[model samples]
Target: MSVLVEVCIDSIESLPIAEKAGAGRIELCSSLATGGLTASAGYMKQAARISGIPVYGIIRPREGDFLYNSDDVEIMLADIHTAKQAGLNGVVIGALKADGRIDETVVADMVKAASGMGMTFHRAIDHCSAPFDALEFLMSHGVERVLTSGLAKRADEGIGTLKEMVAFTQGRLSIMPGAGVSPDNAKRIIEQTGVTEIHLSGKTVRNSLMSYRNEKATMGSGDSDFAITVTNPETIAQTIAAIRA
Candidate 1:
């Protein structure tokens, strides 16, 4: 079977790029620099309208730890509703307790909210204390897939654990290795881990169009670097080809 490639994109512009590059699906989000918070309703709706491939809306309410409070849970539930209404194909969600385990109750609620859409447990699984146990929990709860980097900072570094996770699951659930996935290593990671799906940002820096430079002010933290990172179609195509080969 051909490996599935899912590109993580933060804007509507990248949607068509990913689709054209042969990505089987997209994990739509905002602020990918901060590990991808939830995308706005407007952005989600636009992506749904234009994307040729399936778009799974990321349900993260904010950046930082996956451990969330009641308010955050409520916000995530609302986001799932918005995604469904916007005609998205699915939703990616993650939540954990203070003790480093799956927050079953909250996850159940999120799953229920996504009744008619595909449900993915996001990479927050990397933050859990027991990944194998968590995999069983998610599978039992009816989650369709889990995006994980094998509890390591980068997927290449975590190939050992990823292989183990894939073996343990045995096709009960889909295990997608993500984080730092590049064209050079995409094939190796898949060959070694036995995962049929991979996730990547496929991003490159593009300089701003403004001729007049403003060095004094900045929209985000640090200096006003006129260049912004956006998904590169060539990179996505290369990664997909690597996996296909």
Candidate 2:
């Protein structure tokens, strides 16, 4: 079978674009600017209503490190419940201990709460002290897949670790390489890592339509405060083709 392309989208407007571009799955989120956080309830419901492919809502409760507190766990569980109620097919989750290990108790609670729904342990594994051990822990906990950059800044930069992760899984779980994936290197990453699934936003900047120039105030941290990020159909399609080639 050909590799599956999972487009990570931050808005409902990008949903149809990703689907029409031949995305096999969607990782729904908000604030892609901040590496994606939990998508709003309204967004989740609308995506589930309109999307033809599987939609997995991200369950991250906040930004910053994956080391979550009890309160964060509470919020995550509630978000997972919201995703299910919104009719999403699955939820993506990740949490870690201060020691850079998987938070087994919290993860187990999440897995139990997400019963009957697909679960992807997000790149939090990359933050672990032992990624392989973390993978085994997640597999034992019944997570279906993992999204990671192999503990590096980008997937392509970590091909060796990615290869080892794929070999280690042995079909007990799925390892997906994400982060800085592009059409130019999509085929190389897949061929080198043996991953069956890949994730990317395929986003491009669209300057705000507002003609008024607000030079003084900036709403966000970066220099592109006036620019909007949206999924590019051509980029997604090209990535699919590259992987399938």
Candidate 3:
């Protein structure tokens, strides 16, 4: 069996680059610096129009915890509808309750809203209190795949739990290991966890092309405003090669 590589890209420019690099799927989003928020409608449409591979738009509305209110559910549902209309192949979504359990109601609504499209429960599963139980819930709700780090900070460090998840699923759905995955560790993660699918963002910094700079004013927090985070096709290619090798 072949391993599936899903590259998480924050911009449309990276879509073709990842596809050309042999990524099996694309998880499109914005503000990946802050763990990825929802992509703009225009960005989603542009990505869907040009990408050759499957594109799954992130449906998150904000950067904080996965626990959401009613308004957040409405926003996520609207985003799911937007993704479906934008020609995206699927949506990446997850929501939890205040006590760290899967929010059944909100997730059900999201699954229903994304009726015809593929659905992937994002890394939010790492935050769940009962991961195995949560996996059962997601599987029962018709979630086609799950992007998790085995309830740890990084996939490599969570190999034991990841192994258990793959075994528990029994091939019912995809158990993809994501978070802190790199070319150096990609092959090891697959070999140890028995997960056929993996997720990564081979991200690198790109300097902006502006001759003039207004250092006195800043648009957002963090380093120079001239730097932008973009996907590195070479890194993606290298990671794919490592897994296949």
- Residue-wise C-alpha lDDT for candidate 2, range 57-119, written one tens digit per residue: 999987789998888999999999999999999999988899998888899999999999999
What would you estimate as the lDDT of candidate 2? 0.92
Model 1 Cα lDDT, one tens digit per residue, 93-114: 9889998898889998998999
TM-score of each: 0.97, 0.96, 0.98
Q: Model 3, 1-245: lDDT tens per residue?
A: 69999999998878898899989999998988889999999999999999888999999999989999889989999999999999999999999998899898899999999999999999889999877888898889889888998888999999999999999988887899999999999999999988999999999888888989987777889768888788898999999889878
The whole-model C-alpha lDDT of candidate 1 against the native structure comes to 0.91
- Model 1 spans with C-alpha error above 4 angstroms: none
Count of backbone collisions within predicted model 2: 0
Residue pairs of candidate 1 with colliding backbone atoms: none
